[model samples]
Target: MLDDNLRASRQTAHDRPDLQISFEFFPPKTDVMEEKFWDTVHRLAPLKPRFVSVTYGAGGSTRERTLRMVRRIKAETGVDAAAHLTCVGASRAEVDDVVRGYREAGINRIVAVRGDPPEGVGKPFVPHPEGYRNAIELVEGIRRIGDFDISVSAYPERHPQSPDWNNEIDNLKRKIDAGATRALTQMFFSNSDYLRYLDRARAAGITAPIVPGIQPIHSFRQIASFAARCGTAIPGWLAERFDGLDNDPETHALVAAAVAAEQVTELVDEGVTEFHIYTHNRSPLALALGRILGRRHEVAAVDAA
Candidate 1:
């Protein structure tokens, strides 16, 4: 089975070369982390991403910072910036204000999300009394404020709170009807799962581009924990790849790049041309994976050199 996967990866390595990629980033909370975040931005901006996004924190925790970062990215970088707008804690008016601010700052894109609960993942999400009720509503509200290229979230494995995939697809339809031009999926390891979800979405009349979210493993344990909370499944083979490299950063990074390269290569072979990379304020791994998927580097040759 492993050999078959490797053969497929090699076949893909020799074939597909065109890819349109975007990246996601979260706002930094400290001075040192801020420095690292800018370094990441500088390193990745050269790749010419479709657009780089800044994540809005749970319950609007990083609202100001998200805006500041998005504004700065648009002003300082050549890449287009997309701001994440959510209805977790802010009212409709507040969220609208943020949307207008993005327009004024020349940020013409947004990722509309319902966002996580204030208490954290797994906690019940109670919407603010005067806020938009959900992501679909937020999409509508953003539309009312300005003409922005809105992208809403999609869950390939079904959202944790959703009863089933059918219901999730219906919810996505509503978001599209509300004026979202694109749907970016939650992170999932299996390409087959994304393909199946895409089939279902198309069957349900969703014709917009559904970009798969690709998360390069910075720390297997950390990603596993997040996957557990967000209902993202980590395949056993993936876990096996990172099994005991927790303490060896060197080997860990090598394995991470390899795993991510294989994943993206297989996806590319399957005809997926667009990807969203979740860069957790780190660069080396995501940068490596980007170069690999674009066939800009030879993995073994880089390792050998």
Candidate 2:
């Protein structure tokens, strides 16, 4: 049961009605996974997000699949779709072709990123000889292709490859100069980290919107492993919350919801009105967060394409 304080806070969130949201999804690799992916999409479509994004695989390995999923989401559900474009292994021409394709398809939003090295997160990143060297260059290249509302990545805890927080902030400013309209942070457990980063970003003269990325933890162990790779620190207290609950799925889900609700509500109090959720192609927890944010409404009828 929720405490009275939190229950009242949840009610306050439910009454606001003006919060904006977006969700991210990865392309499904198999038929069964595809079914599950659409189920997640259908369940959340009615909240009417700002735009939903489809993630690109490392080194553009899933380029075709990402484009297909983005297009399908737009055509079938009428929801605005943002395709993630990454600079990793592809040449400038190849990347340009993809950007032009998105323009022709009427998908105008892009999340430009300097993606993980093809080998994986912990490995050294080697840029393709003929490709853009980083996200800043990729953002410029996409701008050259067409008019796009571009978003780039921001690191609250600093990117794994960054030498320091200042370097990461400098890199983000460069991406903004290259035409990105917004920056979405890497997932962070502590709100203070994000608030500090925002202060530094403002001090550095970056005027674009820096959106926080929220991940609803479905599995603590799995997310902990991911945090290790992505440079996000898991607070010791958070780990304590999940302690000894490995076998308790129901309790785990409740705990996850409560933790996320607290995180979001606290951020909202700090004057944040827009959020980007990394859904990981699942729905229940994401939907719960939306409802907790006062986005509850009737479901829209959407047919999968």
Candidate 3:
């Protein structure tokens, strides 16, 4: 079984030169965390990702940190960096200012999301009295500010607040019509969910690229909690794979690499060429997954030579 997986990985490495990948990161809060974040960035930057994005906090809580990180990433690593913009606690003017800031810094890629309520996820999201109402409005607002390459969020399992499929896909369409060039999905453990959502989006006449969000589980407990909050289902088999490994870090890490590799390998077979990875500010698992998908660290190779 292991040999078969290795052969498949080698085959993918040889055949898929068109595979494109991007990484998502969050701003570090403490000095210790900041050191770790930069290390992760420097490590992964050599993979030549399409882009690396810094996430905004709920209600623009990490606004300044996010902006600062992206700027430094672009300057120091020469990687195209994207900033996340959200309409939650801020008004339209405030959000627009953030967009302008990114433009002035020469960072033009924006991930427009109608962020969770300041209260928290699963709570009712109340847009500010003077703010853009939803993601569609946010996308429009960003478009008016600059000719930024915009990306919006998509949900394969349906948004927790969405009533049905039509409402969900309609909202996504409205965002695209507003100027978003791409849609990145929320992470899902089941590939079928993502493929079915892609089919539905195509059938609905949404033509933008819908990139699947792949998350390598650094910690199953934490990821499971996030899945529960975001309406992503955790299949029983996935749970069984991680079962009884809490105290066994060595074995747990191996399982994590194999599981995530299997997920992306299957997606590649299904004709999905682009991926957005949620890195959670760690490099080891994400690096392992990238290598499985045939990404090589260019700088490391040069140094070794």
Residue-pair clashes per prediction, in order, are: 0, 0, 0
**Candidate models: Cα lDDT each:** 0.89, 0.91, 0.93
Q: Kindly provide the TM-score of model 3 when superposed on the true structure, using C-alpha atoms.
A: 0.95
Index of the highest-lDDT prediction: 3
What residue pairs are clashing in model 3? none
Segments in model 2 whose C-alpha atoms lie over 4 Å from true places: 1-11, 299-305
Alpha-carbon lDDT of model 1? 0.89
Query: 1 or 2: which has the higher lDDT?
Result: 2
lDDT of 3 by residue, 87-151 (tens): 99999989988898899989999999999987888999998999999999999999888899999
State how far residue 24 of model 3 sits from its true place (Å): 0.4
Q: Note the residue pairs that clash in candidate 1.
A: none
Candidate 1's residue-wise lDDT over 196-282, tens digit each?
999999999999999999989999989999999999999999999899889998999888888888788778878888899999989
Instruction: Kindly report the root-mean-square deviation of model 2 from the true structure over all alpha carbons.
Output: 4.4
- For model 2, how does the per-residue alpha-carbon lDDT over 220-281 read when each residue is reduced to its tens digit? 99999999988899999999999988999999999999999989999987778889999999
Clashes of 1: 0
